[model samples]
Target: MIRFENIDLAYQGNNVFSDFSLEIAQGEKVVLLGKSGLGKSSLFSLILGFVQPQNGKVFFNENRVDERIVWNVRQKVAFIDQEISIGDYSVSEWLTFVSGIKANHSLSFGGKRLKELMDFFELSRDILNKDISDLSGGEKQRVAIIVSVLLERDVFLLDEVTSALDENLKKKTAEFFVERKDWTVVSISHDPVWLKNPWVKVFDLEKKTWK
Candidate 1:
């Protein structure tokens, strides 16, 4: 349930988007595809209110994404960045800390759910006790993904989420999101694992449109 109406964005002296428009229906899985510097990530920033558009508007679930409603929009959307950073806290401590936040207090993050996600992601339960900084890149990626899943948000903005994972894990990650017909997912990735999924609609930024 996201819509961008004739959006125009610029960075420094360069143009990122010019009269760009797109609409993602509820429960739709759309993948952003293009070479670097095409403003794929900027699209997400526009929707999340991290960057302001010079023209037009962005709407989430019919509400305009502005200062007043941006926080609410963020609370309902799970954003997973390519570089996973959880500070230096141990995994368990980090998860506990985030779960205690006022925004996420209502969601359940019990041991069963934690273990289940770890298993599904091919991660070991022991990782929960490891320091986040000590984990490998791939391990950190899975951990970040686990946090997103535990939040139970219906909308996801995944930016190169599977960049560090092997082929099998990448496929599993793509399948995990694509299979959720009730969830709205907008992902940025170059990995063929996601491109091969029939349910995912590809939006080529080079062409400035969706296929």
Candidate 2:
């Protein structure tokens, strides 16, 4: 659950959000649709404490998010960025590093589950040994998603996550998240596959309307 109340935000003399407000209930699936520069991704930044609103508040699960609890909020939410940038580490090394983080220490990355997810995402297990920098864009995206899944976070912030996937893979990815009844998902995407899901509500950032 996330809520933004009357937010006003700007950067370098340019306004991004003005008196913007939104509330996402638990287990809700929302897709933010709009042209670029509409502050779609900035919403996630506010939720994650990457940026703070000059005028309003951001709340997560009934608790106001601030510096004191930002880490906790991040631990509970999985954010998969459009550009997967985890340096030059190998896939396996990246997985190990993510699982090794203090916030993720309690969540075990089971080899069996990892392989299963990789297979479901149409990725080869052998790719684990490949350098992350060498993987194709689609491969990188799937790998980022798999890592998020392995973390078992109930809330997801997906930013153009299927941007590089093929048509089939895009559908597969959309269906996989749409079927999760207990997960809260807020995504930014232009992919029609996501919008086709009846369970997903589309929020037009530019118009400040929902469809």
Candidate 3:
């Protein structure tokens, strides 16, 4: 559902990507793999329209990604950055605030779903009453992931989401995403937990191509 055709990107005078191209079909789980400074995050930025390509084009569900279509793209995709900060609001307050947003108003993430996700992620129910800023790094990562899933977006852009998580939690998170047959996931991770799954397609930024 996402396609990048001969994309070229640069920062200042340095080139980050040159004639890079990729296509991800619906319900596919793709993991971006490479060392640091290989523009893995920039690929996500390009898809989200946070950064525009100097050449070529990006398309989401057949629509070209540009100023006019970027909003629509954002609505369908849920992005979780490597560093997550959701202000200092309590977990309950934060979730309530997100539910109040116009775009998310139609969706219901009642107590049942919340509890289910928390249980699956091995998070304590007491965390719901804790302030976001007071939570540990791993807790914050799980909370961010839970919030993203609650959005009910079919497409996910996960950037180093399991970086702060332990090995077991990391494996659980990767399995959760890879097992979803109806979701399109593009994850950038250096952890080996994501590599154990044979169904996930691997894209190496070092080679500038997919395997």
Candidate 4:
């Protein structure tokens, strides 16, 4: 569970969240709905312990979320940002390198699991050998989505991850998340089509009140 108790977050000189509060129960799929740069992703940073709130406490279960426990927090969360860079390697090499990261050393990599995921996402097997940099924006986004899933995180922090994908792929990705009961997904998206899922609980970020 993730809980924010009267949290206040600010950056530079602007106040994003002021005395805001909410709790994500054990396995809730919540969506933070707002235009770009409306403090949506910033909330994810707070939940992930990547950024500290100016005031109030962030808690994951019984433990307080802070910089000290961020690595541990990250172990259970996977983030797929809109602008992703898998670096200048072939898709297969990127997958291999990503799986080599300390956090993912225990997981199966670039093998049958990846092939299955790629198939589910409707990506071609040939993409594994293609240059990662040469992939289109939508393709890159899908690759990032696949990588996040490979980590087997219980929570997903998706920041416009499907912004570049076409209608069909977007629906597929949304459906994928809907099927995962263990997933506590907090997503930021401008695409209305993604909101058709029954379990998606939306938070209106543009609202004036912090409560």
Candidate 5:
């Protein structure tokens, strides 16, 4: 379970969101929707503990979201963003490094498991040896998605993850999300395919007053 209680946040005195509240039960798939600047991504960042609200609180599994347990929460959640990890290695090396992270390492997905995931995501075997810079936006997005899926985290925080994908790829990823029997999904998306999905619990940010 997760809760955002009357949260208020701002940047330089400008309101990001105010008096915002929502709850997500385990295994539920939710969508946060509104105009672009209404702090949809900030909501995602808050849940991931990357950003703190100026007031109010965020809770994960009924515990307050704080530094002490943020890492623990992160270990159980996979976040996929459009721009992530433009790095100094080949595509394969990126996977190797991330899988070695403490969170992923504990998941026990070694090279063989990683290869299986890459195959499932439809990544070209050649990408494994290619420089990260050589990958197109779509390829990088797929790689990032594979990384998250391999983590085996039941919860996903996705932000326009399909922005660079074609219709086929979008549906493929959607299928992946749907098949996860225990997934708790919260995504910030404008893609028509995702926005209208009934599996999502919808929240609209436009009705509230900015702080």
Candidate 6:
């Protein structure tokens, strides 16, 4: 449901992408694998309208992603950046605030749902009461993941989300997303655990093609 056509992106005369094109169908799971500076994260920015290409267009579903419909597009996509930060608010407060947002108003954000996701992710229930600043890197990562899942958005753009987790959690997290047949997951990760799932397609950004 995401397509890029002949995209040309650059920063301060440094070109990152040139004539780049890719199409991700609905419910497809793709992983971006490459060294740094390959524009892997830029692809996500293009889809979210955070950045625009100088030449070519980005499309989500059937519509072109432009200023007119960017907000609408963002409402349906969940982007978890490499360095996730929600603010200093307590976990419960953050969830409450997010649930009250206009786009997420319809999604259920209750104690049971939070508890279940926490358990599945091996997070303690007491973490809901802890401030974001108090949580470790791994905890913050898992919490960010939980928030994304709770938003119930079918399209996910995850950037190195498993970087802080232990091996077991990394495997669990990868399996969880890959097993969800209804979700369109595009992730950028150096962790090889994601490659263990035969269904996860790998795109080599440096090569500008799928591996």
Q: lDDT scores for all predictions?
A: 0.91, 0.93, 0.91, 0.82, 0.80, 0.91
Better of 3 and 6 by TM-score: 6
Clashing pairs in 4: none
Model 6 lDDT per residue over 1-211, tens place: 9999999999889999989999999999999998888889999999999999999999999899999878998999988999977778998899899999998999988768878999999998889899998899999999999999999899999999999999999999999999999999999997888876798999888877788
| Model 6 regions lying over 4 Å from their true place | none
Error of 3 at 175 (Å): 0.6
Query: Where in model 2 is the C-alpha error above 4 Å?
Result: none
RMSD to native, candidate 5 = 2.7
Model 5 stretches astray by more than 4 angstroms:
110-112, 208-211
How does residue 143 of candidate 5 score in lDDT? 83
Candidate 4 structure quality by residue, lDDT tens digits, 74-113: 8888888768875789988888898888988999876788
Off by over 4 Å in 4: 208-211
Models 1 onward score TM values of: 0.97, 0.98, 0.96, 0.92, 0.91, 0.97
Clashing pairs in 6: none
Q: Considering summed lDDT, which 10 consecutive residues are worst modelled in model 4?
A: 202-211
Candidate 3, residues 1-211, lDDT tens digits: the string is 9999999999997898889889999999999999988898998899899999999999999999999999989889999998887887998889999899888998876678989999999998899899999999999999999999999999999999999999899999999999999999999996787766898999888986677
Number of the top candidate by TM-score?
Answer: 2
lDDT string for model 1 (112-147, tens) is 888889999999878888999999888998989999
Q: lDDT for model 5, please.
A: 0.80
lDDT, model 4 = 0.82
C-alpha lDDT of residue 126 in model 1? 83
Looking at candidate 1, the ten consecutive residues that score lowest on lDDT are 79-88
lDDT of 2 by residue, 1-211 (tens): 8999999999887899999999999999999999999999899999999999999999999899999889899999999997888898999999899999988898878678988898899998789899999999999999999999999999999999999999999999999998999999999998899998899999989899898
